[model samples]
Structure formats: structure tokens, C-alpha cells
Target: MPVVKEAPLLDGSAGRLVRLYTVSGGRTRPTASLDLLTLVVATGSEPPPRSGPEHAQAMGLCRGPISVAEIAAHLGVPVTVAKIVLSDLVDCGAVAARPPDSFDHPTDRSLLEAVLDGLRRQL
Candidate 1:
């Protein structure tokens, strides 16, 4: 079960303010490109106490491969911010990330164009 707690009310602009403050704390983000679908697995047990709540939550969630988007959603943070945090964990060797299995590059553009043309004609 998710641990639910009542948070103190914040002013309307607190979200951005909080993100800016946390990100400015000077941890360098990892070089790995964290895509929405990239698979992440925990490489360590529970993160050390100083690693912060997000890192601990990520470690717990990543016992199996989980997507960056899901992690971000669970953490209630933006994907960009999550990537930065996850990257830090990766740098600490607490997690392993794998890019998506399918390549985005088109193998045959002419063949794709031909298929598109046929579909267009049918429409």
C-alpha cells in the first residue's frame, strides 16, 4: 500500500518553486538519456538515508524493470526532473537503465512512403 500523508497546504506557485529549489541543490544529473519507456531496475537495496525520499521510493519500485514515466508519476514530479534524480541514482550505481528494445530509425523510408501512399489512396 502507498503511504499516504496529508501535506501542508502550499501557495499556488509552490510546485515550480519546489522543483527549482531541489534541482539547485547541485547534484549533477547522469548522462544516460532517460526516455519515458526506458527500463530501470534497482541495482542496490534500499538507498542510504542521505539519498532522499525520491531515491528510496525509486529503489523500492525498481526491484523489477519499470518505466521512467511510471516512476515520475509515482513520485509526482515532472519527467525531466525525474530523469535528473534517476540519473543521480544511476551515477551512484543504485540502478540500471536500459533503452527501449525497438530502434526509432527507419530501416526503409521508401517502403514506408509506398505504404503511406497506398493508405492515402484508400482514404
Candidate 2:
């Protein structure tokens, strides 16, 4: 049930602080990241959960720009836990962010096959 706010003029990456303006002339700051990964992590609430050793350990476990959900999975904690950590990091500017140009995810093969099969059946 995500409210599509006319698809923000400036699309951004997860775990980074970004400034956005609403269609109604209101400025929106980085309250929190909200990608699919973020949505899973944040559990659809705020200010967010709490950060602890698990977050640090997640940084150690994963070398890349880690998201809340990824960190949670690595630490065997809930995504909620990881998201809190991410929110703290975002506030502190501790996490590095990949540019939007690199915003690419591998396609899910099973989903792709399902769609292809449906198309073939229709044809």
C-alpha cells in the first residue's frame, strides 16, 4: 500500500540521504530510505528501530554498501533491527551510498519464466 507521490522527480538509492520536493511545493528531506529493500527493512514505520552491535557486525560481514535488510539477514536479526541501524547511520552520515546510476538489480529468473510462460500460453 505504498502511496505513489507522482514518482518523485529525483529518484535516489537506498541508505543515502536525499532531498526531495513534493508536487505540492513542500520540501522533503531524507526521513529514511524507501526502496523495496528499505520498505522490508523499515517495516513501514519510523523513526526506525534501534541500532547495536549487530549493525557493526553487519558492516564487517558485508563489504559493499549494505542495506538494512541485508545487514539484518547477515546478523540473523530482524529487518526492523537493521533498518534502525541504517537510520542512525544515515543521520550520522556514516554509510557510503552508490550513485543512482548503479541502481540495478538482477532480474528474478523464476518470475521471468512465469511471465514468459503466461505470454506463451496466451499466444
Candidate 3:
């Protein structure tokens, strides 16, 4: 069997990807930031034809509710770098980001009581 080899770590690749990304207007909207826990979903089957390779890969990976952290891991780059790439996609509407669900409101008293009841029973 042919020997399998792992892909090299980001190292120079990250810098190169980042440089190209910035040159391609990835930083046009500096205000764009993605939460590490935010869920990303691909809005289209693929990224725009002219998009960079990294953007295309990211768009392809976001077919489901994948977290930003997971995307970074899969891309073999740092989370910060992934955020930059993903932020660009967000700006272009190629991907949709869903904020993490928050339970601060507690609108349903019944649901809250049920959770409390379950916890008490487990104790």
C-alpha cells in the first residue's frame, strides 16, 4: 500500500493565504468578526467562481451547522485566520452565521421547571 502522509502545518501557508486574502479585499470590512462558537452554513452550493481557494473550501465545508472552531481545525489554520477568511465570506453573503443560542430570556416557565425537575431527580 502507498504510504499516507499528513498535510503540513499552516506555518508559511497561513501567512501566504492571509496575504492573498487581504489583497483580495478580505479586509475591506474590518468590522466583520465571527464568534468562535457561531454556526456557519453555506448559502449556495459553492462559493463564487472568482473566490480564493480558501474561501471555496470554507464554503464547501459549511454545508451543515459547523462551528467556526471546527472550520479552523479542518482548514489546518489558526482560529484567528479562519475567522478572517470566514468573515470575508460573510460579507459577500456566501455563508450565513448563526449566533449561539442563549437561554437568558427563559421565556417558557414550563420548560425551565421541567429542567429543574430533571436535575432534582438526578441528585
Candidate 4:
């Protein structure tokens, strides 16, 4: 009888590295306009056929509105990778992306002082 040797399994970090690479398909840039604070929500439609697990996972997380950073944290991938996966979903209409609202003017000092005063009063 011939003895067979099984291939060594990847360690946790190595496995995650491979998963990230595979999830992003070795792409480093996202085609969509996505920032850390950009919010994403599922469109209540099924993912396109042959979509990767990352896409499905992203859609699941986006069942409620979620930030790109939050999706990255939940998927255990870098923000860039999360953006790529999200872009794919967006292209297929599985998710919708919304840019965060930006303040047009600098924060008011009075507002800052009021918040500080409120915190002090609470304490």
C-alpha cells in the first residue's frame, strides 16, 4: 500500500490573506466611488449569478444601512477590498451606495462648547 501525505492547511492569518486576495480577485482599486463613511443598503434583490461569497456577505450586512468601514470590519477585510466587493454588488444592482453627507461649514465653536457643557453636567 502506498502512503499518502495530505497537504498542510494554511494557518489562520495565511488563510485570511488568501481569502482577501481571492475575494478581491487580486484587484487593488474599486471602480465605484466609495469612502469609509459611505453608507450601503441592500436593494432587496438577489445577487447576480456566480457572485463570490464576499458579495453575498456584503449584501447580508447591508440588509440595513451600513458604512463601508463597518462592512470591512464585519468581513474581516481591508476597506479597499470591501470597496471592491461592494462595487461589484453595486454594478449588479444587489446593493445601493450613498455618499455620506458632508458639512459645508466648519463646526461651530458654540456647538462644541455646548456638547462639552452637557457632558460635564451629565458627569
Model 3 off-target regions past 4 Å? Answer: 1-30, 102-123
Estimate, for each residue in 42-79, the C-alpha lDDT of model 3 and write its tens digit: 88744567766667778879988899999888876667
Clashes found in each candidate (C-alpha, N, C closer than 3 A):
0, 0, 0, 0
- Winning candidate number (lDDT): 4
Off by over 4 Å in 1: 1-20, 23-30, 45-48, 104-123
TM-scores for every predicted model: 0.63, 0.41, 0.58, 0.71
lDDT tens readout by residue for model 4, 53-121:
678778889989899999999887899999999998888888999876653455789999999999999
- Model 3 has a clash total of 0
Q: Candidate 4 at 67: error in angstroms?
A: 0.0
**Candidate 4, which segments miss by more than 4 Å at Cα?**
1-14, 102-123
Q: What order do candidates take by lDDT, descending?
A: 4, 1, 3, 2
Top candidate, metric TM-score: 4
Q: Report lDDT (Cα) of residue 57, candidate 1.
A: 70
Candidates sorted by TM-score, best first: 4, 1, 3, 2
Q: Which residue window of length 10 is worst by lDDT in model 3?
A: 15-24
Query: After superposition on all CA atoms, what RMSD does each candidate show versus the true structure?
Result: 5.2, 15.4, 7.3, 6.6
Tens digits of per-residue lDDT for model 1 on 5-123? 84532357654334533742554454678889888999864555587666777788899999999999987777877787788778778899897665555358898899999999999
Candidate 3 residue 98 Cα shift, in angstroms, is 1.2
